[model samples]
Target: MSTGQATLPLLNTTLENCRMVIIGVDPHKDVLVAVAVDGNGRQLALRDAPARPRGYKTLLAWTAQFEQRLWAVEDVRHVAGGFVRCLLAAGESVVWVPTQMSSDYRKKVRASGKSDPIDALACARAALAEDLPAAVPDTEARNVKMLLDHREDLVGEMVRMCSRLRWHLHDIDPDFAATIPKHKLHRPKWNKSVQEFLARQAGSVAVAICVELIGRIQELAQRAAQLEREIAALVVIHVPQLLALEGCGPLSAARILAETGDVRRFTSAAAYAMHTGTAPIPASSGNTHRVRLNRGGNRRLNAAIHRIAITQKRMHEPARTYLDNRRAKGNSNTEAIRALKRHLARRVYALLKNGPDHAQADTTVQAA
Candidate 1:
């Protein structure tokens, strides 16, 4: 392929600099494995540096050594936040490649491919070869991402504990949840108030078991609520506009911001949709095909967009009306929601991509 043909303008300056370094990171307990490689994808050095203080220092030193114009690292979603922060703090330009992409490359090239060193080398090669798109580095958004990641971790823990608690309660008392309505399982008030009744049961074994299970579940639920409140507070502090959307609550808004990073990186709404996996695939092959969903992009982003679509179907006028119209025209529920999601993603992309007159444009569209 020609160098300038498929190349985006974003690659111009970096390619000119040519002294690129790709750092493959395997973040362990106290240390992270960092393999630094030159632009030609040759390994330069390896380090077992501290995850927090020492790792960052090593990274800074390495950055100074290369004087590299561009840096690339594997994108590990929530896990790579700290590493990315360290790189950004040093004012280094960073790009992100998904682990799967790098792993597949390694497997294809090298027959034996299951070590940290090899993986690190693969990461370097991926960056040098343009195997993945360069990510928009956003330090401010990283702070927001930290909060979302913390909240997600707490929520996941709470969910697991809740499930275990339910099982323990069921084993002790078969009809424990029978007193409350089935749909109220997710409600904290129901869990809290009903626990008193369980605790007051005549049998001691049932009472003891119920007390233990309820106590654990209650604690988990409380923790989950605290995380929720913290997330809301952070959104209010940093990402206020995201919460302004009709169906976007604090959590969802934070998630969208965290996932998309710098929205301006997307050249157009279509680009944004394609990155988020909301864009329909081009399926024409000499007039032999229809469009289908592209599975090439971020799954989490797609899920987030799907959630936004579902939320808007109930709360936002345009979304709801559009879905209704689609369904009335004989589209299935899934199809209608997908159509709504594509439109919603475009709207979100527009709001983020456009400058100064976003509100006015949104209002004009609303009126029309």
Candidate 2:
């Protein structure tokens, strides 16, 4: 799952009043090994099923023996999309188990060995030991997230292809790089003469490479643009308020909403910031007391926040004043950026939670 780290707290508060059956699954490309356990942690059944619609149906029937069954899935969004989607559509209660937690549980159970069945059992035990949050896979958010990721990949391919063309042009004709505008070089409209010249270099490998890379880049660019339009349309409908923020564009708004399915799940702005990796971590000792930038949490969401902070620092008057004040107080550039990101995180949280009417920023800077 593309989520912030899911930690099993030390308190170990589990479902006590109601008895619930946990069906833990270790999914793979072709098969899924699953184990069902009682609320008290006793294994009920273990089964190996094919990873298909028919197998999913059979698995449901098998688990039906239990009156109330909750599916505990590992990395539901990424590694087990097919099954997770099917389960969510079927309206089954699902809980996500992080890979680290599952592995740690497995080591405690069987210190010397590892296998699908063992992992499945460990997942069930972990679920039984903690109050895991339920997973709600929203159809709209999932579609938008996939499109955003696909567009990013397409953009990366375009950059690689352009870099290859630039390097080849530099090596073949050093003067070509200086004369041709970098931005114009990737277009089909590049002077017809240059194309003819590259085509004439038949004996050289660079000629073939350049021609192939250009074709791929053009195709990728077209697809990326199409995905961007789709993502923007979805964001406008689902999260128009986010777009109203000073620096959040359609893509940025979509990413934040997609990563965080429901704003209500976070109890407060601090929780939201921590989930986004913008919250500072304590780095203090006997002689000094201070906070440092968190290096963990949702990296993609962190990147979106960084982009917004950079945009606001460029043009937003309030953001500039805040940065200037922080700098004047002796904060370094990196620390100032972190503080700004934290502010944006809290701002986004309030906006998402309070609706569009609360879109305006306070313009009151916080202490550095």
- Top candidate on lDDT is 2
Candidate 2 per-residue C-alpha lDDT over 1-368 given as tens digits, one digit per residue, 9 for 90 to 100? 33785422222227563467889999887888899988787888899899888889888888878887788877645658889878878878777666666777788774369999888888888878755545665657787888888889888878777777878878888886567677655566664445776876756787777777677777887788888998999887777788878888998998998877666656568867866889898888996756787865567889999999999889887888889888897777787889999998988888787765654545344554
> Can you list the residue pairs that collide in candidate 1?
none
Query: Per-residue CA lDDT of candidate 1, range 1-368, in tens?
Result: 48763423354323445565566565545666777876666678886677777667876776577665465566665556677766767666666766666776577545394776677667667667653445655646677777767767766776675566566566655686555564444477777766766756677765676567566666666776887787788767655655555676777766777777777556677767766777776656994544566665666677777787777777678777777787787667876776676776777776555532443455111311
* Residue 39 in model 2: lDDT: 77
RMSD of each: 6.2, 6.0
- Model 2 misplaced regions, further than 4 Å: 1-23, 35-47, 62-69, 76-79, 98-133, 178-205, 265-271, 292-295, 320-336, 356-368
Best by TM-score: 2
Q: For candidate 2, what is the TM-score?
A: 0.75
lDDT of all predictions:
0.65, 0.77
